[model samples]
Target: MQALGFEVLWKGKNFARLMGGLWVALRISLIAVGISLVAGVLMGALMTRKNPVVKALTRLYLETVRIMPQMVLLFLAFFGTTRWFGWNLSGETASVIVFALWGTAEMGDLVRGALESIPRHQYESAAALGLDGKQSFLYVILPQTLRRLLPQVINLVTRMIKTTSLVLMIGVVEMLKVAQQIIEANRMKVPNAAFGVYLTVLVLYFLACWPVSLLAKALEKRWS
Candidate 1:
Protein backbone atom coordinates (compact mmCIF):
# COMPACT_ATOMS: atom_id res chain seq x y z
CA MET A 1 0.00 0.00 0.00
CA GLN A 2 2.94 2.32 0.68
CA ALA A 3 4.05 3.49 -2.72
CA LEU A 4 7.72 4.20 -3.37
CA GLY A 5 6.93 7.52 -5.03
CA PHE A 6 5.10 8.76 -1.95
CA GLU A 7 8.02 7.90 0.28
CA VAL A 8 10.35 9.77 -2.06
CA LEU A 9 8.17 12.86 -1.96
CA TRP A 10 7.92 12.78 1.81
CA LYS A 11 11.64 12.49 2.39
CA GLY A 12 13.11 14.21 -0.65
CA LYS A 13 15.57 16.40 1.22
CA ASN A 14 16.77 13.55 3.36
CA PHE A 15 17.31 11.59 0.15
CA ALA A 16 19.48 14.41 -1.14
CA ARG A 17 21.49 14.33 2.07
CA LEU A 18 21.95 10.60 1.60
CA MET A 19 23.37 11.31 -1.83
CA GLY A 20 25.85 13.72 -0.30
CA GLY A 21 26.88 11.08 2.19
CA LEU A 22 27.29 8.66 -0.68
CA TRP A 23 29.66 11.10 -2.32
CA VAL A 24 31.70 11.18 0.85
CA ALA A 25 31.85 7.40 0.88
CA LEU A 26 32.88 7.30 -2.76
CA ARG A 27 35.63 9.85 -2.22
CA ILE A 28 37.07 8.01 0.74
CA SER A 29 36.94 4.68 -1.09
CA LEU A 30 38.68 6.15 -4.16
CA ILE A 31 41.54 7.67 -2.19
CA ALA A 32 42.01 4.50 -0.21
CA VAL A 33 41.97 2.32 -3.32
CA GLY A 34 44.54 4.49 -5.07
CA ILE A 35 46.95 4.36 -2.16
CA SER A 36 46.37 0.65 -1.73
CA LEU A 37 47.12 -0.06 -5.39
CA VAL A 38 50.48 1.67 -5.35
CA ALA A 39 51.59 0.29 -2.02
CA GLY A 40 50.34 -3.19 -2.87
CA VAL A 41 52.18 -3.34 -6.18
CA LEU A 42 55.42 -2.43 -4.43
CA MET A 43 54.85 -4.92 -1.63
CA GLY A 44 53.93 -7.65 -4.11
CA ALA A 45 57.11 -7.05 -6.07
CA LEU A 46 59.11 -7.24 -2.88
CA MET A 47 57.35 -10.44 -1.86
CA THR A 48 58.48 -12.07 -5.10
CA ARG A 49 62.14 -11.35 -4.47
CA LYS A 50 64.54 -13.99 -3.18
CA ASN A 51 65.65 -11.96 -0.16
CA PRO A 52 64.59 -13.69 3.05
CA VAL A 53 64.36 -10.48 5.04
CA VAL A 54 62.12 -8.85 2.48
CA LYS A 55 59.93 -11.92 2.29
CA ALA A 56 59.65 -12.13 6.06
CA LEU A 57 58.64 -8.53 6.46
CA THR A 58 56.07 -8.67 3.72
CA ARG A 59 54.72 -11.91 5.10
CA LEU A 60 54.33 -10.42 8.55
CA TYR A 61 52.43 -7.43 7.23
CA LEU A 62 50.17 -9.53 5.04
CA GLU A 63 49.34 -11.92 7.84
CA THR A 64 48.68 -9.17 10.33
CA VAL A 65 46.23 -7.51 7.97
CA ARG A 66 44.57 -10.77 7.08
CA ILE A 67 44.19 -11.87 10.67
CA MET A 68 42.61 -8.72 12.02
CA PRO A 69 38.96 -7.80 11.51
CA GLN A 70 38.43 -4.58 9.61
CA MET A 71 36.22 -3.09 12.35
CA VAL A 72 38.91 -3.81 14.92
CA LEU A 73 41.48 -2.15 12.70
CA LEU A 74 39.23 0.85 12.30
CA PHE A 75 38.83 1.13 16.04
CA LEU A 76 42.57 0.83 16.57
CA ALA A 77 43.33 3.46 14.00
CA PHE A 78 40.64 5.94 15.06
CA PHE A 79 40.28 5.44 18.80
CA GLY A 80 43.34 3.55 19.99
CA THR A 81 45.88 5.72 18.18
CA THR A 82 44.31 8.93 19.50
CA ARG A 83 44.34 7.54 22.99
CA TRP A 84 47.85 6.12 22.93
CA PHE A 85 49.73 8.58 20.75
CA GLY A 86 47.62 11.72 21.19
CA TRP A 87 47.22 11.84 17.40
CA ASN A 88 44.12 13.67 16.32
CA LEU A 89 42.75 11.46 13.55
CA SER A 90 39.39 12.01 12.00
CA GLY A 91 36.98 9.15 11.46
CA GLU A 92 37.21 9.51 7.71
CA THR A 93 41.01 9.50 7.83
CA ALA A 94 41.11 6.44 10.05
CA SER A 95 38.67 4.60 7.79
CA VAL A 96 40.83 5.40 4.78
CA ILE A 97 43.96 4.22 6.53
CA VAL A 98 42.37 0.94 7.63
CA PHE A 99 40.90 0.19 4.22
CA ALA A 100 44.14 1.10 2.48
CA LEU A 101 46.05 -1.27 4.70
CA TRP A 102 43.57 -4.08 4.10
CA GLY A 103 43.34 -3.54 0.37
CA THR A 104 47.11 -3.35 0.06
CA ALA A 105 47.59 -6.66 1.81
CA GLU A 106 44.99 -8.40 -0.35
CA MET A 107 46.23 -6.80 -3.55
CA GLY A 108 49.81 -7.67 -2.71
CA ASP A 109 48.89 -11.31 -2.35
CA LEU A 110 46.98 -11.25 -5.61
CA VAL A 111 49.91 -9.66 -7.43
CA ARG A 112 52.38 -12.08 -5.91
CA GLY A 113 50.26 -15.03 -6.97
CA ALA A 114 49.82 -13.68 -10.47
CA LEU A 115 53.51 -12.96 -10.88
CA GLU A 116 54.62 -16.28 -9.54
CA SER A 117 52.12 -18.06 -11.78
CA ILE A 118 53.98 -16.83 -14.84
CA PRO A 119 55.71 -19.76 -16.46
CA ARG A 120 59.46 -20.07 -16.02
CA HIS A 121 59.90 -20.16 -19.79
CA GLN A 122 58.41 -16.65 -20.01
CA TYR A 123 61.40 -15.31 -18.12
CA GLU A 124 63.74 -17.39 -20.23
CA SER A 125 62.14 -16.06 -23.39
CA ALA A 126 62.47 -12.47 -22.20
CA ALA A 127 66.16 -12.94 -21.37
CA ALA A 128 66.78 -14.70 -24.67
CA LEU A 129 65.34 -11.63 -26.42
CA GLY A 130 68.23 -9.62 -24.91
CA LEU A 131 65.95 -7.93 -22.36
CA ASP A 132 67.62 -6.72 -19.16
CA GLY A 133 65.91 -6.90 -15.78
CA LYS A 134 63.99 -3.66 -16.15
CA GLN A 135 63.24 -4.26 -19.80
CA SER A 136 62.02 -7.76 -19.13
CA PHE A 137 59.66 -6.54 -16.45
CA LEU A 138 58.44 -3.51 -18.33
CA TYR A 139 58.14 -4.90 -21.84
CA VAL A 140 57.43 -8.55 -21.27
CA ILE A 141 56.48 -9.40 -17.70
CA LEU A 142 54.36 -6.49 -16.54
CA PRO A 143 51.88 -6.48 -19.38
CA GLN A 144 50.96 -10.09 -18.79
CA THR A 145 50.91 -9.57 -15.05
CA LEU A 146 48.54 -6.66 -15.50
CA ARG A 147 46.20 -8.74 -17.56
CA ARG A 148 46.01 -11.31 -14.80
CA LEU A 149 45.59 -8.64 -12.18
CA LEU A 150 42.90 -6.49 -13.79
CA PRO A 151 39.87 -8.56 -12.90
CA GLN A 152 40.90 -9.20 -9.31
CA VAL A 153 41.82 -5.57 -8.77
CA ILE A 154 38.44 -4.44 -10.02
CA ASN A 155 36.78 -6.86 -7.61
CA LEU A 156 38.85 -5.44 -4.78
CA VAL A 157 37.62 -1.95 -5.65
CA THR A 158 34.01 -3.04 -5.24
CA ARG A 159 34.87 -4.62 -1.92
CA MET A 160 36.46 -1.41 -0.69
CA ILE A 161 33.40 0.59 -1.68
CA LYS A 162 31.13 -1.70 0.29
CA THR A 163 33.49 -1.82 3.25
CA THR A 164 33.48 1.96 3.50
CA SER A 165 30.07 1.57 5.15
CA LEU A 166 31.91 0.55 8.28
CA VAL A 167 33.22 4.11 8.58
CA LEU A 168 29.83 5.06 10.02
CA MET A 169 30.74 3.28 13.25
CA ILE A 170 33.42 5.88 13.90
CA GLY A 171 31.09 8.81 13.05
CA VAL A 172 32.07 9.36 9.43
CA VAL A 173 28.40 10.13 8.57
CA GLU A 174 28.44 8.31 5.26
CA MET A 175 25.34 6.95 3.52
CA LEU A 176 24.42 4.50 6.29
CA LYS A 177 24.72 7.21 8.89
CA VAL A 178 22.55 9.47 6.79
CA ALA A 179 19.99 6.72 6.52
CA GLN A 180 19.99 6.22 10.28
CA GLN A 181 19.44 9.89 10.86
CA ILE A 182 16.58 9.99 8.39
CA ILE A 183 14.95 6.97 9.96
CA GLU A 184 15.14 8.50 13.42
CA ALA A 185 13.69 11.84 12.33
CA ASN A 186 10.75 10.29 10.46
CA ARG A 187 10.04 7.37 12.79
CA MET A 188 6.88 8.89 14.24
CA LYS A 189 5.29 10.30 11.08
CA VAL A 190 6.44 7.80 8.46
CA PRO A 191 6.28 4.51 10.30
CA ASN A 192 7.47 2.52 7.29
CA ALA A 193 10.15 5.01 6.34
CA ALA A 194 12.92 2.73 7.56
CA PHE A 195 12.11 0.16 4.90
CA GLY A 196 11.99 2.73 2.12
CA VAL A 197 15.17 4.50 3.20
CA TYR A 198 17.14 1.31 3.63
CA LEU A 199 15.86 -0.03 0.36
CA THR A 200 17.05 3.14 -1.31
CA VAL A 201 20.46 2.71 0.23
CA LEU A 202 20.59 -0.87 -0.99
CA VAL A 203 19.66 0.23 -4.47
CA LEU A 204 22.30 2.93 -4.42
CA TYR A 205 24.98 0.50 -3.35
CA PHE A 206 23.91 -1.97 -6.00
CA LEU A 207 23.92 0.74 -8.63
CA ALA A 208 27.39 1.78 -7.63
CA CYS A 209 28.88 -1.72 -7.35
CA TRP A 210 27.07 -3.73 -10.02
CA PRO A 211 28.87 -2.01 -12.88
CA VAL A 212 32.25 -2.76 -11.38
CA SER A 213 31.25 -6.37 -10.89
CA LEU A 214 30.14 -6.62 -14.51
CA LEU A 215 33.37 -5.05 -15.66
CA ALA A 216 35.38 -7.56 -13.68
CA LYS A 217 33.42 -10.41 -15.17
CA ALA A 218 33.86 -9.04 -18.65
CA LEU A 219 37.58 -8.64 -18.19
CA GLU A 220 37.89 -12.10 -16.71
CA LYS A 221 36.03 -13.65 -19.60
CA ARG A 222 38.03 -11.73 -22.16
CA TRP A 223 41.34 -12.58 -20.51
CA SER A 224 40.41 -16.20 -19.96
Candidate 2:
Protein backbone atom coordinates (compact mmCIF):
# COMPACT_ATOMS: atom_id res chain seq x y z
CA MET A 1 0.00 0.00 0.00
CA GLN A 2 2.89 2.36 0.75
CA ALA A 3 4.54 1.49 -2.53
CA LEU A 4 1.29 2.08 -4.40
CA GLY A 5 0.65 5.40 -2.61
CA PHE A 6 -2.68 4.32 -1.09
CA GLU A 7 -1.17 4.35 2.39
CA VAL A 8 -0.58 8.08 2.17
CA LEU A 9 -4.32 8.63 2.39
CA TRP A 10 -4.27 6.91 5.80
CA LYS A 11 -1.63 9.23 7.22
CA GLY A 12 -3.29 11.55 9.73
CA LYS A 13 -6.38 13.49 8.61
CA ASN A 14 -5.77 13.43 4.88
CA PHE A 15 -8.82 11.34 3.98
CA ALA A 16 -11.03 13.46 6.21
CA ARG A 17 -9.69 16.61 4.57
CA LEU A 18 -10.61 15.22 1.18
CA MET A 19 -14.15 14.51 2.42
CA GLY A 20 -14.44 18.03 3.81
CA GLY A 21 -13.24 19.42 0.52
CA LEU A 22 -15.85 17.38 -1.33
CA TRP A 23 -18.52 18.86 0.91
CA VAL A 24 -17.30 22.37 0.14
CA ALA A 25 -17.54 21.71 -3.56
CA LEU A 26 -21.00 20.20 -3.17
CA ARG A 27 -22.18 23.04 -1.00
CA ILE A 28 -21.17 25.64 -3.52
CA SER A 29 -22.71 23.80 -6.46
CA LEU A 30 -25.97 22.97 -4.67
CA ILE A 31 -26.44 26.53 -3.53
CA ALA A 32 -25.79 27.83 -7.00
CA VAL A 33 -28.09 25.26 -8.51
CA GLY A 34 -30.90 26.25 -6.18
CA ILE A 35 -30.50 29.91 -7.06
CA SER A 36 -30.29 29.17 -10.76
CA LEU A 37 -33.46 27.06 -10.80
CA VAL A 38 -35.58 29.83 -9.32
CA ALA A 39 -34.06 32.67 -11.35
CA GLY A 40 -33.81 30.67 -14.52
CA VAL A 41 -37.49 29.73 -14.39
CA LEU A 42 -38.38 33.39 -14.23
CA MET A 43 -35.94 34.29 -16.98
CA GLY A 44 -37.27 31.50 -19.14
CA ALA A 45 -40.86 32.59 -18.71
CA LEU A 46 -39.82 36.08 -19.72
CA MET A 47 -37.95 34.76 -22.71
CA THR A 48 -41.17 33.25 -24.06
CA ARG A 49 -42.76 36.69 -24.08
CA LYS A 50 -42.53 39.20 -26.93
CA ASN A 51 -40.93 42.04 -25.01
CA PRO A 52 -37.98 43.44 -26.96
CA VAL A 53 -36.09 44.69 -23.90
CA VAL A 54 -36.32 41.33 -22.15
CA LYS A 55 -35.16 39.61 -25.32
CA ALA A 56 -32.13 41.82 -25.69
CA LEU A 57 -31.07 41.51 -22.05
CA THR A 58 -31.63 37.77 -21.83
CA ARG A 59 -29.78 37.24 -25.09
CA LEU A 60 -26.84 39.25 -23.87
CA TYR A 61 -26.66 37.28 -20.63
CA LEU A 62 -27.04 33.91 -22.34
CA GLU A 63 -24.47 34.75 -24.97
CA THR A 64 -21.97 36.12 -22.51
CA VAL A 65 -22.16 32.98 -20.41
CA ARG A 66 -21.85 30.83 -23.51
CA ILE A 67 -18.85 32.70 -24.88
CA MET A 68 -16.91 33.13 -21.66
CA PRO A 69 -14.89 30.34 -20.15
CA GLN A 70 -15.93 29.25 -16.66
CA MET A 71 -12.39 29.86 -15.43
CA VAL A 72 -12.44 33.42 -16.74
CA LEU A 73 -15.79 33.94 -15.07
CA LEU A 74 -14.37 32.64 -11.79
CA PHE A 75 -11.41 34.97 -11.98
CA LEU A 76 -13.65 37.87 -12.93
CA ALA A 77 -15.93 37.23 -10.00
CA PHE A 78 -13.24 36.46 -7.39
CA PHE A 79 -10.46 38.83 -8.46
CA GLY A 80 -11.93 41.44 -10.77
CA THR A 81 -15.10 42.19 -8.87
CA THR A 82 -13.34 42.77 -5.56
CA ARG A 83 -11.16 45.42 -7.16
CA TRP A 84 -13.88 46.99 -9.28
CA PHE A 85 -16.68 47.07 -6.76
CA GLY A 86 -14.61 47.15 -3.55
CA TRP A 87 -16.60 44.21 -2.26
CA ASN A 88 -14.52 41.73 -0.36
CA LEU A 89 -15.89 38.39 -1.47
CA SER A 90 -14.49 35.12 -0.16
CA GLY A 91 -13.42 32.41 -2.57
CA GLU A 92 -16.41 30.22 -1.77
CA THR A 93 -18.76 33.16 -2.21
CA ALA A 94 -17.18 34.10 -5.51
CA SER A 95 -17.35 30.50 -6.68
CA VAL A 96 -21.04 30.34 -5.83
CA ILE A 97 -21.68 33.58 -7.67
CA VAL A 98 -19.82 32.51 -10.79
CA PHE A 99 -21.35 29.06 -10.96
CA ALA A 100 -24.80 30.51 -10.29
CA LEU A 101 -24.37 32.93 -13.17
CA TRP A 102 -23.31 30.16 -15.49
CA GLY A 103 -26.00 27.77 -14.28
CA THR A 104 -28.72 30.39 -14.60
CA ALA A 105 -27.89 31.04 -18.22
CA GLU A 106 -27.76 27.41 -19.16
CA MET A 107 -30.90 26.60 -17.20
CA GLY A 108 -32.78 29.54 -18.67
CA ASP A 109 -32.14 28.23 -22.15
CA LEU A 110 -33.20 24.76 -21.12
CA VAL A 111 -36.40 26.10 -19.61
CA ARG A 112 -37.11 28.14 -22.70
CA GLY A 113 -36.57 25.11 -24.87
CA ALA A 114 -38.85 23.01 -22.71
CA LEU A 115 -41.57 25.64 -22.73
CA GLU A 116 -41.40 26.13 -26.46
CA SER A 117 -41.46 22.43 -27.19
CA ILE A 118 -45.09 22.16 -26.08
CA PRO A 119 -47.52 21.86 -28.97
CA ARG A 120 -49.77 24.75 -29.87
CA HIS A 121 -52.67 22.32 -29.76
CA GLN A 122 -52.05 21.76 -26.11
CA TYR A 123 -52.75 25.42 -25.40
CA GLU A 124 -55.73 25.42 -27.71
CA SER A 125 -57.05 22.31 -26.07
CA ALA A 126 -56.72 23.87 -22.67
CA ALA A 127 -58.65 26.92 -23.89
CA ALA A 128 -61.26 24.67 -25.39
CA LEU A 129 -61.74 23.09 -22.01
CA GLY A 130 -62.74 26.55 -20.69
CA LEU A 131 -59.49 26.98 -18.85
CA ASP A 132 -58.33 30.53 -18.29
CA GLY A 133 -54.75 31.41 -19.18
CA LYS A 134 -53.48 31.10 -15.63
CA GLN A 135 -55.51 27.98 -14.99
CA SER A 136 -54.33 26.44 -18.22
CA PHE A 137 -50.73 27.13 -17.40
CA LEU A 138 -51.01 25.82 -13.91
CA TYR A 139 -52.87 22.60 -14.60
CA VAL A 140 -51.81 21.78 -18.13
CA ILE A 141 -48.70 23.59 -19.24
CA LEU A 142 -46.76 23.44 -15.99
CA PRO A 143 -47.11 19.70 -15.60
CA GLN A 144 -45.90 18.99 -19.13
CA THR A 145 -43.17 21.61 -18.94
CA LEU A 146 -41.89 20.15 -15.69
CA ARG A 147 -41.84 16.69 -17.17
CA ARG A 148 -39.63 17.80 -20.00
CA LEU A 149 -37.58 20.11 -17.82
CA LEU A 150 -36.76 17.74 -14.99
CA PRO A 151 -34.50 15.30 -16.80
CA GLN A 152 -32.45 18.14 -18.24
CA VAL A 153 -32.32 19.76 -14.86
CA ILE A 154 -31.01 16.58 -13.29
CA ASN A 155 -28.36 16.45 -16.00
CA LEU A 156 -27.42 20.01 -15.14
CA VAL A 157 -26.95 18.99 -11.51
CA THR A 158 -24.32 16.50 -12.59
CA ARG A 159 -22.66 19.10 -14.78
CA MET A 160 -22.50 21.48 -11.87
CA ILE A 161 -21.06 18.78 -9.63
CA LYS A 162 -18.25 18.08 -12.09
CA THR A 163 -17.66 21.74 -12.87
CA THR A 164 -17.25 22.56 -9.18
CA SER A 165 -13.70 21.28 -9.59
CA LEU A 166 -12.93 24.56 -11.32
CA VAL A 167 -13.56 26.42 -8.07
CA LEU A 168 -10.05 25.40 -7.03
CA MET A 169 -8.64 27.91 -9.50
CA ILE A 170 -10.10 30.75 -7.47
CA GLY A 171 -8.51 29.39 -4.23
CA VAL A 172 -11.53 27.50 -2.93
CA VAL A 173 -10.03 24.48 -1.18
CA GLU A 174 -12.31 21.99 -2.92
CA MET A 175 -11.63 18.32 -3.44
CA LEU A 176 -9.06 18.74 -6.17
CA LYS A 177 -7.19 21.33 -4.16
CA VAL A 178 -7.19 19.07 -1.14
CA ALA A 179 -5.86 16.27 -3.28
CA GLN A 180 -3.07 18.53 -4.45
CA GLN A 181 -2.23 19.50 -0.89
CA ILE A 182 -1.97 15.87 0.12
CA ILE A 183 0.20 14.97 -2.82
CA GLU A 184 2.46 17.97 -2.33
CA ALA A 185 2.92 17.13 1.35
CA ASN A 186 3.95 13.57 0.60
CA ARG A 187 5.88 14.19 -2.62
CA MET A 188 9.29 13.18 -1.32
CA LYS A 189 8.00 10.10 0.44
CA VAL A 190 5.67 8.88 -2.28
CA PRO A 191 6.81 9.69 -5.77
CA ASN A 192 3.75 8.06 -7.35
CA ALA A 193 1.22 9.69 -5.04
CA ALA A 194 -0.07 12.04 -7.71
CA PHE A 195 -1.56 9.20 -9.74
CA GLY A 196 -3.25 7.51 -6.80
CA VAL A 197 -4.47 10.76 -5.33
CA TYR A 198 -5.90 11.98 -8.61
CA LEU A 199 -7.44 8.60 -9.29
CA THR A 200 -9.16 8.76 -5.93
CA VAL A 201 -10.47 12.21 -6.71
CA LEU A 202 -11.74 10.99 -10.04
CA VAL A 203 -13.47 8.07 -8.43
CA LEU A 204 -15.05 10.27 -5.80
CA TYR A 205 -16.35 12.62 -8.47
CA PHE A 206 -17.73 9.74 -10.48
CA LEU A 207 -19.44 8.35 -7.42
CA ALA A 208 -20.94 11.73 -6.69
CA CYS A 209 -22.17 12.30 -10.23
CA TRP A 210 -23.14 8.83 -11.43
CA PRO A 211 -26.34 8.56 -9.40
CA VAL A 212 -27.50 11.94 -10.67
CA SER A 213 -26.75 10.83 -14.20
CA LEU A 214 -28.74 7.67 -13.72
CA LEU A 215 -31.69 9.63 -12.39
CA ALA A 216 -31.63 11.87 -15.43
CA LYS A 217 -31.59 8.85 -17.68
CA ALA A 218 -34.42 7.22 -15.79
CA LEU A 219 -36.46 10.40 -15.98
CA GLU A 220 -35.96 10.70 -19.71
CA LYS A 221 -36.92 7.08 -20.16
CA ARG A 222 -39.99 7.32 -17.97
CA TRP A 223 -41.16 10.54 -19.54
CA SER A 224 -40.18 9.90 -23.12
**Which 10-residue span in candidate 1 carries the lowest summed lDDT?**
3-12
| TM-score, prediction 2 | 0.93
lDDT of 1 by residue, 94-170 (tens): 99899999999999999899899889999999999899988998787877987989978988999899988999989
lDDT tens readout by residue for model 2, 1-224: 56569878889999999999999999999899999998888878878888899899999999999799999999999999888998889999999998899999999998899989999999999999999998998899877988888878988888999999998998899999999999999999898898888989999999888887787778778878
Distance from true location, Cα of 148 in model 2, Å: 2.0
The all-Cα superposition gives candidate 1 an RMSD in Å to the true structure of 2.0
Pairs that collide, model 1: none
In model 1, where do residues sit more than 4 Å from their true spots? Answer: 1-12, 217-224
Error of 1 at 10 (Å): 4.4
Output the lDDT of residue 180, model 1: 85
